[model samples]
Target: MTTIHNGVSPRAHAVQAAAALAASMGIGRFVYTPILPLMHTQSGLSASLGATLATANYVGYLIGALAGILIPGVVRSAAVMRTSLVVLIATLALMPTTHDGSIWFALRLVAGIASALVFMIAVSALHAHLRGQSQFLAGWGFGGVGLGIALSGVLVFVVRFIGSWGTAWLASASLAVVCAVAAWGLTPEPRPIITPDAPGTPSSHRWFTALVISYFLEGIGYIIAGTFLVAAIDLAALQWVGSGAWIVVGLAAFPSCALWAWLSLRWSRPTLLLVALLIQAVGIALPAVIGGVGPALISAFLFGVTFLGIGSIALAIGAHLQFPRAVALLTAGYSVGQILGPLVVTPLLRDGYRDALLLGAAVVLGAAVAAAVLRFRFPSDLDADPRTATSTEEVVFDVR
Candidate 1:
């Protein structure tokens, strides 16, 4: 394991990374879900415009991901992470100041970009500092997103009774500020020095292609639910049920990565990935098929548990493949899919969110089918060159 600067313990590093994720991913990016209902009833935000705003954010996320890939140095800079955190905070705070849809879109777009940068920086830091630590440490760090989600959900749930959508946005921004303070000292991963390499068995490109396709499909399916699940539940359940379900989602998600990491020790990543997708598909479709608070909460729980787990497992598999720029390529594909998710289901939104959720469920099943393809003749043993194998192992750990 690489030594952390200033004698920061691995646990402390994970905590900082988690705080960054909580602020950037959980509060900044996803606070929209619980707040969407308020926008609809309180602010006259139509379903079409809502979907459009969501798409704008995803587009911005793709751009940010591309920037990280193109300029690798930015991923290693604490300044970049801090700037993104500030930008994210500003975006959330500014959201309530205007009723103009265009301004909302722009704010969300910029927030998406900042969220992506924070995510990349936090993940890089976790990978660098907790290299050989228990996978549970990284899993707990990822759970920070869940913690943020739960906290924001609670905020919105309370504000819905006493305030308006603008209040929700402002409160979320305040929460992000608190998280940013905790993450202020986080260190980005240092750039590695390249050394002469030894020959090793080349990873199977065919499998890598399958992995990419599966992950891309997952991006589409996951974001649809992430954006609209609360709204969908609100359609059929009590007024409080929607936000309550969202809170359930956050609670379920908080420990999901750690659970998945523990399971990965006993099961192959591909198998676990496939199972998770299948479970998520069922969760997404549950409320669509059955209407009520029970189904809605259950759906939230299942979706929350699997979404982050899927990402962690998929990225770990990409690292194991040892393909060149595999993480970047996979991330790009996933981002593009996220950009398409809302647009692909926009037409369905006119009827209601149910059709959209059903569509999302089907797409996730498609991703699972793609994952199943990876189970055949998969390379479980990599007894190749020791140096190459060690590097791959480090990547897998980092990804987890």
Candidate 2:
């Protein structure tokens, strides 16, 4: 086992991990959402094309996640983390150089892959370095994404004055550079060597199936709202309302993981997750049905609050299952759902974002149903060590 450097508390390492996620997952992977409207308003990018670009990024994320699962050695490498961070910066910087949609798609794809590598490396490092530390530290670390979102939202708002989308991309990359520098000294623990579970009939673990299915459905449901929520607001409400909503999301999300972790101590993970999914469904649908600045802001707040919480609780349940590579498996399933989300809703774009929001709500409702089933079928599966709830849940999964 490896310990953090002398004088560097485990909490500091957790902060470093959070900063890495803020840069990679929040800024690198998600800065796109705030930027999408800019591209459409200024660059004449169509909604269908924007959805295609989002899917391209999600595909890259899925590929990157699969690599992490299949090649653990690579995921644990410090060199890989450093390289991915640099490449992610480069990809963002490159975005401004090209106006071609194909080129933009390729850049987003590469950014997605680089962001995943940085995210997985940062998270795995936290698990190793922060061992035996309070799980609340991990919660704060996860809050980095919301912080990054807020930062990027503010940047984009500044861009509204500057009147250039390119500057927003460049500024976001600079922030990533700062994060990379801060996290450069962060060290990863030696990868754990685990004995493989003996082969058995897969059907014996019905609960695992339900968990993965619910997580997968969550992937599909949450993303449509995440990717389009700001864009929808911009179109339906005031121009500033979209970016303002995104900032609200960031503010609400900052403390959500820690709040959810605290709640998990008293409530079962399944019940907590089910409740989150149900609330998130309403959040996702609110803007579509209600139609106003208030509802838009409320949607952003509720969506931001629950999306991360659901991921935390669901993956925590995966850890409780004690399956080999449980985290990796759930990640893969969730990634697939993300890839499918924008693509599944592309046809609905012709009808407008309201249809997409409604579709997202329906899928999230399905996810809630799955969570309810998990709770009913596996009542005792929610027990977790009071001190450790698998910080893997803390990773700021973009569009989760």
Candidate 3:
């Protein structure tokens, strides 16, 4: 008989967690990218304002991440997740009801906070319940973000022909409602029994600092593409091409974490991290350097394949270091990088998205360089706990 926890099977819990991720991350946070073009054309939102809005959302995400780290109780509470889901849906629904830019900014900001909370709670649940299960199950759960992205992209793509940006937001809200229902039964991670650990040699700060710098750079570079890829593609490609490419990105991302996780079993993570970042840099620059329907789609695929995987590898590396509050520190650095991404590129946006994308690619290459530094004399065997051997694999399977 299948073991049940609080009336939900482990498989069922994973499914629910996936649904929650799809709702909060895929639809709640990312639907903005596809809808951005519509707002530009129909709502008359300026490029600078759009960048500001994106920044606001990132700021909110940082706040939410910090909250989870500081409170501890929040990540363990089902009520927090439920409330965040409701708030997320509310933000999406209210977004279409106003033409005021400040309101839009506030809504996106709240949505960001809610997205972070939902994401943390869902991930915690997975880590708690899915222990000892096949790592593939966790990968699939993380892929929920990609699934949500694809669904929202399809919704916006169809709405482009028939409705305004408002309609797109409303439709996305409805889709989120469906996902929320599916995820409603998800259980929060139960609190763990506390135990002390054996003392060990201190981790090398030099390598850890290199890893932080690389991951921080990754945050800046990836968010630029994440926020503007569709818009950038729309500039040079056909009308359908932009949204179509986003769909491709989502589809490619859906299986990417699982693929990366499986590969880590064979290759060292630092090697894989460098490889992923280098490929992502190429993907980010492809559309800018070579504009065409083909290049856009190829660019989308490459980006989708690596962005989440990079986060997985970087966090796993942090865990291996066993730095104090490593996950929180890395997450904070990443969140700050995300907030800075759009602002750094705002001046470039005045011309078009091309210059911004080129800059983003350059930053990612910088991150790859840092990753290269980390690989030199990396302490892959730093953690002597045999029980923690799978830590790298577990972290790699999770989406950021």
Number of clashing pairs per prediction, in order: 0, 0, 0
Q: What is the lDDT of residue 57 in candidate 2?
A: 87
What does the lDDT come to for candidate 1?
A: 0.86
Q: Residue 336, candidate 3: how far off, in angstroms?
A: 0.2
TM-score of each: 0.94, 0.92, 0.95
As a TM-score, model 1 comes out at 0.94
Please list the Cα RMSD from the true structure of every candidate, rounded to 1 decimal place.
Answer: 2.7, 3.4, 2.7
Model 1: residues with Cα > 4 Å off, grouped in runs: 1-4, 195-203, 383-400
TM-score winner, 1 or 3:
3
Preferred candidate (lDDT higher): 1 or 2: 1
lDDT of each: 0.86, 0.81, 0.86
Off-target runs (Cα >4 Å) in candidate 2 are 1-7, 198-204, 377-400
TM-score of model 3 vs. true structure:
0.95
**Candidate 3 has which clashing residue pairs, if any?**
none
